[model samples]
Target: MLGIKTVFTEMLGIDYPIIGAPMFLVSYEELAVAVSRAGGLGTIPLPNYRTLADLKKALESIRKATDKPIGVNIHLSGKFPWKEQLALCLDYGVRFFLTALGDPRLIANEVHACGGKVFAGVVSLEQGLRARNCGVDGLVAVGAGGGGHCGSIPALILVPYLKEKVGLPVIAAGGISTGAQMAAAIAVGACAVIVGTRLIATSEARAAQAYKDAVIAAGPEDIVVTDRITGNPASWLAKSIEKVEKQPQLGSKRWLDIWSAGQSVAQVGEIKPAGEIIKDMAREYSEVCRCLKNTLVP
Candidate 1:
């Protein structure tokens, strides 16, 4: 097995250290299954769900896809009850969780009660430390290229910097797309990696074809950091940006009208299946590791 030798792999029961972030619209059971089958943890973002039953059904669907370890993402600040998801997770044996957008301490005790582990996302040293203090098992140190309400610095800086500041495992995200990039993340003190935009371009992404096309066609400069995507700061494709910029004269565009992610929007070129992408990244990483060891020793 291609083990990562890290807490992420150990806790999540996966081989690769990579994880599929809980992308709002694109993340679902299919994507999660594909990711898990490829040796990484997959996540379902539950903030978009309006009711407990909605989340319940989503979890059921995820179970239908794969029996491997899968994660559930929680918006800590939302009124939605974490208790509900927590109950379901325990009942269904879901243990790995990526908690974001609020206080990790708020839910840590409850999650741990269910024998679940938490990996919380942060943008700064302070935030990372806070999560540690709150008893998070690890950190998802979201950096510059991360999508959907992200941080300002690059992952390279954030991951290493946070590692020095805290004692927990770190999973770096934002702008990581390829196996080479995943290798770079681990080399920089990250124990694992989480990818969002890369999965967005995948065949199983639950997005409109036009949205997928827009992401593939985007360039770095074509992306815009817009607060309009949701009630938070997030990156958008230029088309979404233009639509926001045009701002619709007669009436305003609602949060529901925009597409969003982090600054990593331009890194992916095509949408393959999530399973395919995860498997390919792992295979490529294995090959690269072998090549590097041979070149260095010979």
Candidate 2:
């Protein structure tokens, strides 16, 4: 029955405690702005940009599209200019940052100095504590069932675990695609939820039609984890596993064609616009909360 007034939503200035989790090439300006305009936090992934110019253009595009605050995800792989990316995003008015795969201390410090909030995308309890020590404003507890680089533990256990130990606002990620799932995350002490796979099927997402089709055709059983793509454990489509393995190199076009999605894709029935998706989720959320409120009265 939790409303829009949560630590996560209030801090991010969003109407819903939902974030469109950033995806490598799938998240872009259009999708990001769409989600932001629909009352959730939309995020731009740094990896999606091929160069600094591309990043700048995308940021400018998003700014022109929505006046609401937006977020950017920086994957600390040391493969990109992390500092430069941060500076560029800052200049473009990005106030919320999501960090993954490395120590967030430097990023957190820099962002905090500029009155920005830093959220560390953590796959485990240890990572959550580490992010907190780095002075991150919040934690994104990515569970085992999440898309991309995910954790070994499930959200049902991880959310409450971080809630007890990290002492920061927790954004539960993984296996959350609907309002009922969002309510479940909040019930377990998460201040908000991050949705990725569902957004991939949105019209604004940059994912190829084949990729979106694969996600639509998939069920929970079709979601599997593999280390072939990024040399790290990441969730992907079982159907694409063979195709990815057939690629001679990791960067091969065939490999790039492979798609990744979470178990929640099973619940996604069609490809809609990102704004419509968020609106539907918000409506469902309110209805779910009202139903829960009635239950409490009885």
Candidate 3:
């Protein structure tokens, strides 16, 4: 079994150091439940909910499926009515939150007041420090090669930097899709690895079949970072680029018509259930650790 202890695991009360990163539209009740049931943190992306009732229903569904702790991801932009959504989540008994896109200070304070843990998604050292100062419990250090909006730095450098500089548990996000990569993240100081693209290909994910197919067929070179989709730097398939190339205005384009995936898409060769994926990762993690341990001279 893959087991490790860190502030992240302790705070979330999860066994495995893996997080099914909240992806808009893709992350919903089923996927979250599967991840939580598999002993990893499962997160519902708030944007997937059209209203407070929708969010509550999803939360209820997740509760029905698993007894494990559940988390919600809220994009911290002015247009999202994030305060209202946060209050709704609190009412629904959500104790873990991951915020991105804007200042997390206000949200962190509110969540902290309610005894909830808040983790800020950051791409750069400056953002990590800012999140720490905002009283966030930890940081999701999303680096280049991550699926959505990500920083230019690689996790190889960013994870340790944030762990050393921020003095908090840092969850590495980017280009991680296998047990070896998970081990690599921990070796570099991350408390866990936030998986995005890998989960997209999972059975529980709500993404379209075509999107999942595209990801399954992709390679590292096929993942392109483009700002045209959400007006922020995010990784997407080359086909997504081609789809949006002729659109005169970004507003005229349909967001999900194309697909987003990280450089790790190459590692996702098959579509499996969310729980099975976690177990596979755990098995691979154990094997990798065992192999590495044999290399040491007594």
Candidate 4:
């Protein structure tokens, strides 16, 4: 087992400082359990389940699979019954939370009361600072080339910049699919890295087979940021954009069929098990670090 210690790993009690990004439709119980069992923090988004009962069942399944620490993603957008979802997660003893698209203040106190940690997904320094003030434990710096909604800054720049300004445990996200990339992020002050697109192609992902195939076939150039999906700047496959543009009737819900991906899609060669993916990443990260150590100027 490869264990690279970082603030994130110590805080989450996980062996690897890798977090399986809480994807909207792609992440579920099976994927979360696999990633957690492999020593990484796995998370499922609250909106993935249609009802509170469905969410409870998923949580039960994950608990059944692994006793390791896992996370739940809460969308604060007010579009869903997020309050109820948070209550359910708290009742189930879920201690880690990843919040996005709204104010973290609403749930920060509640989560903290239960001795839980909350990490907010942020795209800019402004958001990072606000989240910090809201009492979040960390920030998921979602930069350009990240799947779904993203910021204009690249992860290489955003990670260090957020670490400097916000003074929080920063988790770099975007354009990160390989171990070398993870090593680079850590070198630039990121405490961890959240991987979304790469995991979408994993066998444990709940994404449709065609979605996984599309991710495998895509290159960096094939990804484009557009607001056509949800009226927010989100990265998506160019083919999906074309499909959405052709069918105007489906409206924003077109994303149900049209897939979202990041530039990391270029690195997804095949569908492997989530555990294998994490293991390979950890091994490769160790090798890359060793190689870098040898190349450093004395």
- Tell me each candidate's TM-score: 0.91, 0.94, 0.94, 0.96
Worst 10 residues of 4 by lDDT: 250-259
Residue-pair clashes per candidate = 8, 0, 0, 0
lDDT of 2: 0.87
Task: Give residue 238's lDDT in candidate 3 (0 to 100).
Answer: 84
Which tens-of-lDDT digit does each residue in 92-189 have in candidate 3? 77888998777778687788887789898889889888888888888888989999787799998999999899898898999988989999998898
**Which is the winner by lDDT between candidate 1 and candidate 4?**
4
Local distance difference test scores for all models: 0.79, 0.87, 0.86, 0.90
lDDT of 2 by residue, 1-298 (tens): 3347788888878888889889988989999999999899999889889899999998888888888989998876688788899999999889999987687886877788777999888888888887888888888888988888878899979999998988888889998999888888988999988899999998999999989989998898998887877899899898887776777586647757777898898788899998888878777888888888989753
Top of the candidates by lDDT: 4
Best by TM-score: 4
Cα lDDT over the full model 4:
0.90
TM-score of the candidate numbered 2?
0.94
Q: Give me the displacement of residue 10 in model 1, in angstroms.
A: 1.1
After superposition, the stretches of candidate 1 with alpha carbons farther than 4 Å from their true spots are 1-3, 228-231, 244-254, 294-298
Q: What order do candidates take by lDDT, descending?
A: 4, 2, 3, 1
TM-score pick, better of 1 and 2: 2
